[model samples]
Target: MNPPEPAHTPQPDVVAAMRGDLADWRQWLARVIVLAYAAAAGLSVVAFSKLCDLAQQGFASVLAFNPWTPLVWTSACTAGVVWLTRRFAPAAAGSGIPQVMATLDPAVPAEARRAFVSLRLSVMKAVLTAGSLLGGLASGREGPSVQIAAGVMQHARRWLPPHPGISEHGLLVAGGAAGIAAAFNAPLAGVMFAIEELASRLEQRSSGLIIAAIVLSGLMGVSFFGNATYFGTIEVPTLRYSMWWPALLLVLATGGLGGVFARLLHASITGQGDRLGRWRAAHPVAFAAACGLAAGAIGIASHGASFGSGYGYTRGLLQGHVDVPLLYVTLRVVATWLAVWSGVPGGIFAPCLAIGAGVGHDVAVLCGAQADASALIALGMAAFLAAVTQAPMTSFIIVMEMVGGHAMVLSLMAAALGASLVSRWIARPLYAALAQAIIARGRLAPAVAAPSR
Candidate 1:
């Protein structure tokens, strides 16, 4: 004690270094958590989608599925799922893409955060979206899977210590891209989608995390599902001058039709369709039941062709294992609109893909293009998706990866461009418009959520 406590003091340099180390540790921990949770989310989506597929088929089989059985069951189940969504998780209603799109906006209101992105919303989406399919709503799990994965990553971000040095927008963007990559097993498309659709300009600091998450999540998907084209082995024939005619026709048809569909869908949801949209808003439950009944009736008319996600039918057509009648395409388009219009939790991606396949088959048959059947179907699916989402790069890349269409990349790119241009005449971009609606509703802004010191 006498030798004294000469100056027991910490060095400023050492102290500053310690603080920096702690900050870094916190951020790294958050990032690690994001990656691990993303993998788990991706795996869950795969399993859940498979389960939904099984449920749809099982319910159909048990009911003996006569014309009336499918009609009654599909309608009844639709009404039940709608009730559940309305009572428990209204946010879980509708395709979740719009909600995720809202997360990337700097001007988004703080109050809207819980409605659009949260752990609770994701779980409800998983349970209810699966339940909706079991009701034969003709939807897909792939789209909802994106919102679910984003929720997981968003929740995981909360585990970080205060001041983790990550931006809120960056976290959401990275999570979304990771989700898409994992869901489709298309990592490159994930990055492209984030760049094109989510953010206007992605800063260098945030890009690394985005890439890492996509790679990690995509690997997770690959590990669980095994490497395979989404619709099975697609036979992309070598392009010829003769095939160019069909390609051009497909681009125009898919782009125009897809644009019209997008505009109609937006109009219905935003109450821009006047009386019908107003009526829907006024009587949400009854409207949902009516939509369900319409869906059931359509399913019966189409002989169940308009049921589930249209995955099997589309894949069958592409693999040349089944013949697709034009009536099937019309019924699917009608079914999809009815389901989406009902304010039920569903996605347009798989249904659109199937519709496009049906369109392609019709085009091929009508035009007598024997050699370009596979190419036409691929072109339609890619082009229609491009037109609907307006993220042409992501659309083509995802279709390319899923269908193994690298040999026809030029054709695919052309189709996407054509579709995008035509779609522009139909309406404002879909996701951007929906995101703005969320912002206007919530009144959140960039200044509301400044980084905490």
Candidate 2:
């Protein structure tokens, strides 16, 4: 009892000890979060591979049909997607990136805030993405995959025990990075992407968690998918000093083109969704049928070059087996742009890859540099992704991991950095800017602002 005297006795050591314990707990929590992100990332990879297999099987089935049958199938699928979008969730249309940006933007209002984790959006996105794949749209599944993974993680937060001061935005970034890692089987790229593209801020503390999550996700993906490269093994080429000038030129041109494409895509798809909504409301089945018919016609004319994720075409470009001329690349580019702009549910990521490969192929042939087509294709990929997403480091690292080996690192770095700079000069970051526009237009209400860190 006598010892209980002096309630205000000095205890600097106790405070210091408490602070040390808190720091240790924070580190432990950070590790756990990273582990969770890795698991999610691994699942994302499995999901992407399954989707790819399904898409491939679907394409094979359609190809087995008579030429006319493909046309009919294309029309039917496109029409069904349009009807479903009009009926169920119009927000599910397009690349899904813009919607994601809108969802993440802090300026969005509370009541008007669309549920990022809504099961409805998930189901609709899956359905629309499958439809786009089947309907011969030139899109990828990565964007939808990103949305699905983000939504899943958002919903998962409810069950997670509350952490004293954890940020949901960080979780969302982790999920998105995992999604990309899973999709491409590239963990490092995903980590960089989380910081450069998704996270508005770049700092060691914030990046530490995201990086851990990305690595974990990538590891998980490899565990499930057998640690194979996304595009198989790539043959690295010898670099020559003479080729630098041509590579630089290719980077600049492709980067500028990517910026233009980004601008056009945003303008065409954003407010235009409402117009399609009105059209569908007035003539649902017929409008759907017309869209399907147009898709079929394009597919047939392009001899199926315009279908799916453009993987076949990308492969062809990589292998130096593109059967068509440069004009075909242009056609495919326009087709992809229009297909997505017209409200097809898919992603531009893969299509951009295809476009980049085509551009690289054409450039390589024109320059008469007997460089390995695959190397050129890889460079093109980095440049195009950098230009479109304005995430050069992410694009460069992702391509390197996807392609494997270090022979082409210098080329990739130069091209990606150049392309990113060129694109940035031409346009604002595509998704972030789009999110801001949506907020400005009152389409989405602002949310509680989170410090980017």
Candidate 3:
């Protein structure tokens, strides 16, 4: 009893102990904050889907009332959006993924945060992305979704009564994952993508928060979408033992091609940016207009095949309904790459998936073995995504969720790993290269320090 009393007397101040406990509690609370935001993000996806559906319906109605009416309106809207972006928020041009990466870069200055997250920039992104969709641009919603979600989270953080003491990088990563989860209705993939592709410095501790946020967001998304699969139910055919070798060959071919596409996109986008800066110094509007006109022409030629996220087209590819020839796939790849490269406010996520599916379809036909076409499409998706993004695990998870085929996990994993390895050997990571280009251009100030906790 005397020894116990002496031990108790030797303990540190009670207040200090309480303070330490309070700090730990605050950290836990902060992590919960990210998950809560993720839930909100999932809700946002459902909302966005509704908005898109309404927009499409409205356009159809307007077209019915007066044939060619919506196209005219869409053209005007596109031009207006281009003008707004050129005049007010040039940085909002293109996919905004690089912008998010720029913000998270430890080399960028904190003082420039306002410029990156400005209301004007956010508005411009919204308007342009909406206009692109209406005007039949070969773009996807995911990029604008990422930008808008990130802006929302950034502002939300500031609004907290006493802002959490976590770093902005954490919030940015969480926001991006939420955006992807909401956009694609694939929350696990979003979380894995953030960890594998976006995190400036990955760690086990940070990964836990990202995973929690992604799961919450995904659940929220399912609530809105009624748990429907994004790509519908794909009936994957069981692989015959003899088909394994051919499947491997398909994976290698697509992986190599995907790597080439990623490299080409990186070169064109950055090169065009540089050339436009010099050639169109006083005519940003003209540059944007040219991009819009090219997009419109491409849309008309492709007969809307390459437009939007290619969601319908992707489904068609998987179902073998599109009859998309290799040439069509090539054309789509080039058009989508150009649309994004020209600084249109859109995403490459859907387009890339479609490309991968198309490539897979072609490979399946080439194999001439009556393989499961849907399964081949799924493998193509994982392989091409891994090649482009260099995130094999994320790509694998995303295809699995999109197709809802856990049975094909082994095939997907093999394709993804093989593709990722081939792509890494062939080309640099896409986002990293994009980030470097942004920094080299001096469009963003260098990061001053890593965000502090």
Q: Report the number of the highest-lDDT candidate.
A: 1
Query: Over the full model, what C-alpha lDDT does candidate 2 score relative to the true structure?
Result: 0.70
Best-to-worst order by TM-score is 1, 2, 3
Per-residue alpha-carbon lDDT of model 2 for 297-395, expressed as tens digits?
A: 776787777667777777766666666543666767777775675566778788888778777877777788646567877899889988887878888
lDDT of 3 at 356: 85
Off by over 4 Å in 3: 1-36, 54-79, 118-123, 160-165, 200-207, 272-282, 446-453
In terms of TM-score, the best-performing candidate is 1
- The lDDT, on a scale of 0 to 1, for candidate 3 is 0.71
Better of 1 and 2 by lDDT: 1
lDDT of 2 at 426: 76
Global lDDT of each candidate: 0.77, 0.70, 0.71
> How many pairs collide in each candidate, listed in order?
4, 11, 7
- What TM-score does each of the candidates earn? 0.89, 0.84, 0.84
- lDDT by residue (tens digit), candidate 1, 1-453: 367567877657987888886767777787777667767766766676677777777767844646677566777777788889889987777888777877666555545665677888888998888878887887877678778777777776667668655566776776677767877888888788778876766767756766787677777778877888777667777677888777778888888888888888887766675787887877787787788888888887886789888888878888888875548877998899888888878888888888888878878887898567988998888888888888788888988988877887888888888888888888678877766665555433444343111
